[model samples]
Target: MSDNQNLLAGQRRALILDEVRRRGGVRVSELTRMLRVSDMTVRRDLDALARQGMLEKVHGGAVPVPEGRTHEPGFEAKSALETSAKYAIARAAAGFAAPGGAVALSGGTTTYAVAQQLVEVAELTVVTNSVRVADVFHTAPRPAEGGPARPATVVLTGGVRTPSDALVGPVADAAIAALHFDVLFLGVHGLSEGAGLSTPNLAEAETNRHFIRSARRVVLVADHTKWGVTGLSSFAALEQVDVLVTDSGLEPEARRVLAERVPELIIADAEEE
Candidate 1:
C-alpha cells in the first residue's frame, strides 16, 4: 500500500481504538457507521488492532484490553455483549436447578441471565451476591391470590457492591459460609486452562471461592468469548467444575478440551433461543 493509504489506515485504527477505549467495546457494525466505512474495512481495522494487541476482538466487536490484571468493566459496560449466547447459556444452566432445591448464583451479566431463567422454578431458595440477579426474582410476577404462592425465595447477600453489581467482601463471604446449595450457577470474567476461572476483582474472587465450597455441584455459566482470557485472580480450576454450560459459539477444539476437563459440558444453540 502507498504511504497515503497507510496513513489513512493508521488514522482509522487510531479512531477505532479510541472508540473502544471510550465505550469499553465497539461492534464492527457500529464502527462502520461511525467511521463511514464498509463492514469489511471495519473488520480489517479490528483485525489489525487485535494483531497489535491494542484491543481484543470478540465475535462481532472489539474490546479494549483490560488494563493489567485489575481492570474491570461495569455491568452496563458488559451487558450488551454476547446477549444471545448468554441467554442460551442461561437456558442450559437453569436446567440444573431442580424444583424446590436451593441454588447459589454469583454475580456477572451471564449469571444475571441465569437468574432470569430461574424465576419460574417452584419453591426455589436462591442465594445470590448479585443485586441484579436478585432483582430478577424480586421483580417477577406473583402468583394469583387464590393460587398457590410458590415464588422463588431470594436472599441477597449484603456487602460492598463491585463494578459488575456483585456484593463482595467479608459480609458476603460470611453469609455464604452458613449456607449450602444443591447447585451453584457461577459466572466468571474469564476462564482458561492455566488460570482456570478468574476475575479482576480480588474480593469478588474470594467470595466466589466461598460460593464454590458451599455448593454440592458447581455449574460454570460462561460464553465462548471467555476462553483464554485470564483475570487478576483465579477462583476455581477447570477440574473443580462439575458441569460447564456454554454457548455453541465455542470452537470444536475448545469443546473437546473442556469436555475432558469438566465432568459434563452442555453447549446451547444460540440461534435456537
Candidate 2:
C-alpha cells in the first residue's frame, strides 16, 4: 500500500507540472479538483515540485520560475524579447566585421541577429558556438540570379548545448583556443561595471573567455535591458571590451559609465514600426 501511494504521488506531481507548463500557471483549488486530491495534498505536490526546481509556488498556486541569475531561459523565450533592440544592436555591430577578415560570434539572440547581416559580407569567415547562428549561414539564400556567390565561410564548434542553444564545455573551449579572429561579436545575459559580461551557464563563460582571448577586438553586442543584470558566471571585464553596441533605451547614467569603461559605445535607433 505504501509503494502504491508513492507511485500515485509521483504520477500526480507529473500531471501538475504538465498543467503548469501548459497553462503558464495553476491554482491550488483548480488542481485539487482536476486531480481529485485534497487541497493539502495539492499544496504538498506543488511544494515538492518547487523544491526540485520544476516550478515556482506563488500565492494561490504555482507558476514557472522567471529566468534569474541561475535560471537560464531557452532560445525561443529569449528570442522573442527585445526584438527591435537586438536588430538595431546587431546592425551596428555587423559594421565592424570587415570583409575578408575572420570574425567570431558568441551565442545569444543579439549575436544571432548579427549573423543575419554578416551573410552579405564578401569572403568573410565566421566562427561560432551556436548551432542556430550557424544555421543562419547554412540556410542563407544562394547568390541571386547568377551573381557572384561569396557566402561567408562558417565554422561551428562542437560541444554540449545549453538551454539558450549555446555550445559549451571543454570541447568548445579547446576548439576556440586553436584559432584566432580579427574581431569577436559577443552577446551576454548581463553586463555591468562590476560583472562585466556574464552568462548563467558556467561552461559558456569559460568558452567565452577563450573567444575573447582568440580575438584581436571584442565588440560586445547587447540591448539596453541587459545593462545591470548579473548572471551566475562572468567571462570578461569592462576594460577588455573594445566596443559596445546597444539600443537607445539605455539610461544616461549607464551610457556615461559604460563609455568611461569601454573604449567605444555606439547607440543605435531601436524605434519599432
Candidate 3:
C-alpha cells in the first residue's frame, strides 16, 4: 500500500473501532458515510480487524468481541442516565450486603454506583474487575468510631485491558474462579426476553460467566433503559440470576417479563424517598 493509502487505512480502522465502541455496534452503510470510504474499502478494514479477533462482523456492521475489555463511553454521556434510580438501586443492593462479607462487583456504571454506597459500610472485602470501581474505595475514608476501617479490602483483578477499562481474559477468569463470594453484582448492556443478560463484548461475557460461577448469589444491577436492547453475548440465563435490581421507571411490560424470567426482581424507587 502507498504511504497515503496506509495512512487512510489506519485512520479508517481507528474510526471503525471508535464507532463500534460508541454505538456498541455499527453498520457498513454508516461507516461508509462517516469515513467517506468505499463500501469495499471499509469491508476490507473490518475484515482485517475481525481476523485479529478485535471485533465480530455481522451482516452490515460489526460488534465488539467479548473479552474482559470494552469500548469506552464518554463520561458525560454515561452520567446522564437515571441518576436517582441508580442511587436507589445502589442503596437497596447495598442493604443486601453484610459487613465483613466477601463480594465481587462487576464493571459498569451501575456497579460503580454500588461501590460508592459501599464506602459507608465497614469490614467488607470487595473483589472487582473494574479499575474505576476499585479506585472508588481505594480513597474512601474510615468511619469515626470504627472497630475496623470502612471499606475493608478491595481487590482488583489482573488481565488484559479493554478500551472501556475492564480487566478481562483468562487471568481474570482464573482469579474469580479461585474465590467464592457471598454475592456478585453484575452490570449489563441489555436485558431481553430472548438474550437474557447480554453485553456488547464477548470477552466481557466470558469473564462475567466465571464471576457468576464463583458467586453463591448473583444480583444484576441495571437501569430501566437496558431492558430491551440486545448485545452480542449472553452472560447468564434469567433463571441463573438470584435477583434483578432496577429502577421503578421500568416499563410494566418489562417488569412482567423479568418477573416471569428471573427468580426475584427488586424495584428501587429513588423518587419515593
Candidate 4:
C-alpha cells in the first residue's frame, strides 16, 4: 500500500479503538460506514487490533482488554470490610425497585446489602446465586406492627458454589437464561477504566455476564475500594452499565472518568445514616 493508504488505515484503526473505549464495543458494520471503508477492511482492522491484545473480537464487534490483576475474597470477609458503604449503596439501589418487579441480584456483599433493603419491597421476584441473599427474604416482615411478610420470592440458581457464596457454571447459566429481570443489581470484584466490571473467578464472571444480559437495566452497586483492583475476567464495561451506585469513597479523578463513561453515576453517601 502507498504511504497515504497506510496512514489512513492506521488512523481508522485508532478511531475504532477510541470508539470502543467510549462505547464499550464497536460493530464491524458501524466501523465500516464510519471509516468509509469496505467490510473486509474493517474486519482486517479488528483482526489487527485483536492480535495486539488491545481488544477481543466478538461476533460482530470488539471489546476492550482487561487491565491489572484481580482477586476475590470470601463473602464474610468482604462483608466485614465495607459494612457502612455496602449498606448505603444497597439502600440507594433498593429504592429503584418497584412493587411486583423482577430483580436479579448477583452474588456480592454490596448486593446483599441491596437485598437487605429490598425486603421492604413487596412481591418482588428476586433471583440470586448467593445463599445469603436468598435468606434475607426467608422471614421478612414489613416494619408495621404484625405487618405482612414480604411476599417476595427468591430464586436461587443451581450450580457449584464459590467461597464468595456465588453459584456458577452450566446450571446457573441455564437458570438465568430462562428468566428476565426489570433490573439487575450487580456486584463486581473490581472496576477500572480498562477492565470495566470484572470478577476474580472465571465461572463467576460468566454467571455475571449472563445476569447482565437477562436484565433490561443494569444497576451496579460497588464501593470505592473496587476502583483500582481488577479481576481475571471482565463481563461488562461502562457502556453496558445503565446505572452505577457507588460510595463517596471514590477518588475525584475516578469519578470524573466514570461520569464521562457511564450515563448515570450515583455516588451514594455511605456515611449518611
Tens-digit per-residue lDDT, 44-157, candidate 1: 878877775678999999998866678787786566567778888998888898888999999999999998888778899999999999888888888888765554578999
Please give the ranking of all candidate structures by TM-score, highest first, separated by commas.
Answer: 1, 2, 4, 3
Task: Tell me model 2's lDDT, rounded to 2 decimals.
Answer: 0.87
For residue 40, give model 4's deviation from the true position in Å: 70
List candidate 1 segments past 4 Å from native.
Answer: 1-66, 146-149
Model 4: worst 10 consecutive residues (lDDT sum)? 1-10
Pitting candidate 1 against candidate 4, the one with the higher lDDT is 1
Question: How far out, in Å, is residue 262 in model 1?
Answer: 0.1
Off by over 4 Å in 4: 1-70, 142-149
Candidate 4 Cα lDDT to native: 0.83
- Please state every model's RMSD to the true fold in angstroms: 8.3, 10.1, 10.2, 17.7
Which candidate's TM-score is highest?
1
Candidate 3 stretches with Cα past 4 Å from truth are 1-76, 145-148
Give the range where candidate 1 is weakest over 10 consecutive residues by summed lDDT. 1-10
lDDT of 2 by residue, 1-273 (tens): 233234477667767776886699999999877887689999998887777667899999999777678878777656656677888888888899887999999999889999998888888888999999999999998887767555558899999999889999999999999999999999999998888899888999999999999999999998887989899999889999999999998999999999999989999997742
lDDT of 4 by residue, 153-265 (tens): 78999999998898999999999999999999999898999989888799988899899989999999888878977788888987899999998989999999999999999
Ten-residue segment with the worst summed lDDT in candidate 3?
68-77
Model 2 segments more than 4 A misplaced: 1-65
TM-score versus the correct structure, for each prediction: 0.78, 0.76, 0.72, 0.72
